[model samples]
Target chain A: MMRHWPIFFLTGLLSACGGGGGGGGGSSAPTQICTELNTPQSFTSVPLSAAPSSQPNSAPVTVEAYPTYGNGNFNIPYVTLQVCNGTHCVTVDHVIVDTGSYGLRVRADFPGISTLGLPSINNGSTAPIAECSQFLSGYAWGGVYSATVKIAGEATASPIPIQLTNDPNFPNPPASCTSSGSNIGGLNGLGGNGLLGIGVLIHDTGPYYACSTNGQNGPLNTPLNAILTNPIVSFASDNNGSILVMPSLANYPQGELTASGTLYFGINTQSNNTLNSTYSILPTPATGGNATFFSATLNGQAGPYPASFLDSGSNELFIPPLQPPGTYPLNSNGDYVPQSLQTVSGTATSLSVATDTAPLSFSLLDVTAGVNAGNTAFYDMGTTNSATAGSLDLGMPYFYGHSIVNGINGAQIQFNSTTYTGPFYAIH
Target chain B: MPYRYRWTVVLVGAIVTGTTHATLGGLERDVSHEGQPIAFAAATVHPLPAVPQGVHQQTILNLRSITLTEYSANGTVFAILWSGPTMPDYRSLLGTYFPSYQQVIQTQPLSPGHYRAPVAIHQPNLVLHASGHMGAYQGSMYDPSAVPTGLSITSLGIEP
Candidate 1:
């Protein structure tokens, strides 16, 4: 329905780009399309971990971080979650802690945990709903089911809606979601069993289906309480947002490896997650929504891409191509520069060649405050040539040296008294 | 059924000619112009509006979830850059190029990035590199011979 994607080659949006009102990520509101329920229900800090003795079961909720079995580019954080249906409790591991999206999506079966024989949430007429979580490279197709989900030692609410990728019964996906992308929610695609999207949006909306007679596409006119859900709102307290506290790696590993970190539940609920003032407050609002940028410049050219946000799920930081769409600009023949680095971590040295690109410089405001006051990380985004409709993506590589707080969608984040409804990421 | 509508070129009530990705590599630029005029539509894809690059005239077609760039110089299609939600339907998008594509794509080690799949194919007659994940995907294809003498792919915002 469109003719020449006309939003490229902009100098104006970049000129006015102030960046990171810290109002980013997650949906601004939970609507028929994207659901970010600003449920009046309050959430508190409840840490659930395999090593409960080692980590607290209270506020500043922390989950362990580990490396994936095959791929090592991503920091695969595992949260022990219990999916219950008043009948049985099923726990699983290798749930990626991704801040790029929202909602809880898992496989119906794990290595040790069997199928989550949960009940389905039909569209009143009894036709079940299927969700297609569309990724850039692919999509994850699954059926919508409800079960009491436990994350980090606490139960947000019983019977929260979730999409089950591993469910055998509803394995058949409607063709609408697959027409554009393929399903990668399985092991080969995500490199994990499932993803725990704690980003700003409540529901990961892509293509929804009313599963009855082989299924149909578009939005599934189901009620908010029944569709895919971000379990945070169901918590008794600390529902506003969560924090990812990944410690600096001693040395970035260049091969299949492992590391450790933590994922906390609320932003300001406890002393551990209290919004620190020194950090920059950048707002990453829901897709197609308006927000700010810290400030950006490319090739000494001011205002190329305005803002840059964080996504733990993404492995590398992708910057806009040096030259505009039709023009090629770089000293390198291709966009990638296969470079490796070995840094001294404490007394030891570590090497990592995760990104195969040259060095690049892009500026960004940090974990807390205003725009003019921010930091820039060195990266060689190496000429990424996609037409993504958002600011630059500061993936897992960007999260390495920093601790970020993803303020919940529609939650209020405050710098003293200057209160703002969130969808923001505070990085330190 | 988002993007299943196929409109074969009906020019002035007649079928005009164009090129597909496979055959376009060696064909004239106009063949491509005729082949893919508008991909999907979007707000980020650039409207060429007759913009000029090093030695080419370019317009970008954003297929909602994809971005296809058309470059022409010396009266022939020189190079094309495509980044889409999924691999462009290789069947039609690849056309004649599909035959030799698998040998290059499957044999090459999986390219790594934020997106798990990184396809780097460099056949004798064609060269293409594509990668994507989540909701953003990108790729570029070009015939080394079709490119202008002094021009490089990097000059066209393409990685080497």
Candidate 2:
């Protein structure tokens, strides 16, 4: 059956432009945490740990500021999630919460952290160890165990499914289960023990039977989406939602711009954060759909077709090269190619780039209201290339210097800045 | 005892059995375009039906119902076909590779907005192939006129 993949994009939509640059982040406000179901949890106020200090001289690295929901809920700013092993407990900041995927991953270096749970593998009567491959960055392989997560001040007992790496449980790890992108590093560097995929749905995909060349009649296994989970939806109140807000830019080549907003948890907390109107949504193709961006020529061969997507889980922009089909181990000189910007046409004389601190800007308008009013951002060049999707994935880099409001259920995006202020929701 | 055909018995037989009963020997079917065959595969009875003791020969039987099921190696059902005793054989309708495609009757170009397109019914042969191991099925569907067109689906049909 053809599943309705939501389509969101701007095509011959509107000509409205200009940004209402203004409000921003950074206040001495103490961190506050809340969930959809449970009461808010009050903790000793603490400033977020400073982002990693080191910078790659040639390569661009992007570090993003995301929130941890009360344990498993969506990103509610200043929420405390108690991540615990069997013995110890540590509260970590939850940011960049998402609903598009599943599984619970946490940074290994997070304070007050101790144990991890591993999944069980049933081989007839014997239960063996196992691991999972999360195609994006890396894999979260471990035995399953139960851990308690406290969000919005509510406590859930152990018997929770978790991933446990770096343990002596599995003596030999399969090369296929590990990541080929392990060596690559960035702002949201891959040092975390694992990521928490708190998506609404679980199981990577449905079950499948295996027919191997070895003549093994038994089933060849893959990770079922049912195993991994979103902690919030499973929490006492099931706060399974998120908001994403980015300011609009004043056209490309227009120099530095910025916008700020808040990502709230529930729909009722509409005052501060709200969604003005439905904006031009793009079709987020299902994973493995692998739709290639064919320089969809406008008139003649205008050259260079660049595509961008808003992904919160990713902290920085990633650009990959296109390739031909059927070749697994991509040859260095394969057809996969990446192009650079040359010009913005009619608007600018030419588009140029220096390896320094130049930034690109984008526009933001509700799909419903069209592009009337929005904010912009000053984006730092993070990477020159990637091994994944041949297109660029816009992450928190666009939200810097401004308050980003991700309207989960419409009027939930909130931002108050000096130059720009308004219920930016309901622009229509 | 070979009894001669009696007028009374012939009249009774004519009234009770109106439909012709033809024994289908070595049953086979095929799909074609215009009239050329594209691909062909054969199916056979499994385990062979039991032969009664002292039976001198195999009895010729007309195929009443054909239940065709295609599955993955692990027995995952991909397609199932039930011909209501008289339905056309999909194998003979869709050819080897389903070439008979549907074309778009109306063209409404989308401009970056949500749209719900009504489900277009392809020829029944393609539908049968789609119900079976869909892995081999191409996305281009055939319209009533057998013109090929793009199909982006959102949901399955609801039960009546």
Candidate 3:
């Protein structure tokens, strides 16, 4: 089992900071196996139990985990793909559609994908390439490979390159990446087949490297092939960007088990992908540059949460928890609110958003409340922050009934073609 | 109780030049905790089989992106560090210390734009300091009570 596969994604993440290594004179305890955090549950693709009518879009997007591979609490959506070398294609399902991360990472030995005789991506070296993808808590270690990745039956432009997790070529993860992260990439630890990150970044700046047979390696910069790339930017026809269209369970407390949705490719290429003229743009943050590529402000307060991006990979509205936890108003059900009506000067409190000052007011929900309860989707909600590095991850719950658009990093979409660069996010 | 807001140090110290917080990748000698600050006469490039055991001797283990050195007190773990590709998993590493912070994670809101900057969760029992991205994943936490009498946390690689 090539477990520590995702470590290559965050090569210098630690070194980039000024410190290196822990202190001495201490008896190091063996890292205890966290059964709760590392439980490998078998999840099946349960049909959308409370299935909503499928939205009018091209491809089928599912929030259901493949049976035997469900990620415990993260309500991430999945899509299937047919990756091939010409006609010898294998259909790989459960690819996470992530807007938070950049590029594609698939399990090298995943059940069906390993069968395909995909070519090794050398990144200019005869020796194989490895990557250390740093997650907030851990890293994904894997190697690079080449293939044509198709979504919704349409082929991505060129021979789409991707990260082959747990590269069979370099099954042994170096001690460096493993000390910080887990032994999961794609199918092993992470609950999906592979991830289809269609966010704005064209290439993942997360680290990748070339490895020698005896385990010697270094930082690699072979741009076109070494990095996990966002395929939307590589598409020939609808080349601009894409949008996730999910219906609003606005009032549904506990979200439905299976909410049918569609992930439309390209923002304005087709009739249904047009921008909603009446909607205001929240603007893709130029906040972290590369760090926190999509940061957001809570209420009117600004950020310390870097890694904040619209993610379909997460399960809830994951932002830094507000202090005191009392400033926000609670609804009758004790659920924190997204927008509430309160009369400022009168003797009564209004309970509707139409009131003058209640348009985007949001609140937190009870954390222990299972997503299946009537208290599923949360907007004003924010949860605990990762002490190591903080981020405000807008998980799957943020997509309830919203059409979030990501304009590719350099590609322009507006009719003017020059107003906005690719890599900006817009919600309608 | 004041340490619960140790985050203040994280915010303010980031601006202070040369003050060690938890920058793992560039970790240097024990300036704060050491009887006197000194550089590694010879740094080991190979990784240790497991974290070595000792309180006074520095056990440096090299990993891909970062290296770790553990500070000990009579075989009791006092501080654990990380510096490299990314940060370590605090949930698992922190063990019992994680619950309280997880339950009542409170921080004073700062001016705008500092939101994504970095934060320090200061508590009496355990102090957590972290920040950075790919090349800069740095952070560390230690129990003040767990430290042996003469040792300083700064000497253990954490900034006071």
What TM-score fits each model? Answer: 0.59, 0.38, 0.61
Q: What is the lDDT of residue A162 in candidate 2?
A: 47
Model 2: per-residue Cα lDDT over A265-359, one tens digit each: 33223232233333211112121111111111111223132323333443333323322222111234221112222211111010111111112
Question: DockQ for model 3?
Answer: 0.07
Please give, for residues B60-128, the per-residue lDDT of candidate 1 as tens digits.
Answer: 332233446656665456566665333343433444565566455344332223334344556776776
Candidate 1 lands at a TM-score of 0.59
Q: What is the DockQ of each candidate?
A: 0.09, 0.02, 0.07
TM-score winner between candidates 1 and 3: 3
TM-score, second chain, candidate 3: 0.54
Tens-place lDDT per residue, model 2, B8-83, is 4323433344332211111111000111111111221111222222211111101211222211111111222221
Better of 2 and 3 by TM-score: 3
Cand. 1 Cα-lDDT: 0.47
User: What lDDT would each prediction earn against the true structure?
Assistant: 0.47, 0.25, 0.48
Show model 3 residue runs off by greater than 4 Å: A1-57, A68-74, A186-188, A214-224, A282-307, A326-363, A367-382, A386-391, A415-418, B1-126, B129-160
Writing each residue's lDDT as its tens digit, candidate 1 over A60-153 gives 2222223222332233455667677776787766677777666788865565334546777665465566565655435566667777877675
Q: TM-score (0 to 1) for chain A, all models?
A: 0.68, 0.46, 0.71
RMSD in angstroms, all models? 13.6, 22.9, 14.0
lDDT of 3 by residue, A240-347 (tens): 667788776655443455566788876666786767564333334222223223323344444444334556665555444444345544444233443432111101
Sorted on TM-score, best first, the list reads 3, 1, 2
lDDT computed for candidate 3:
0.48
Chain B TM, per prediction: 0.61, 0.17, 0.54
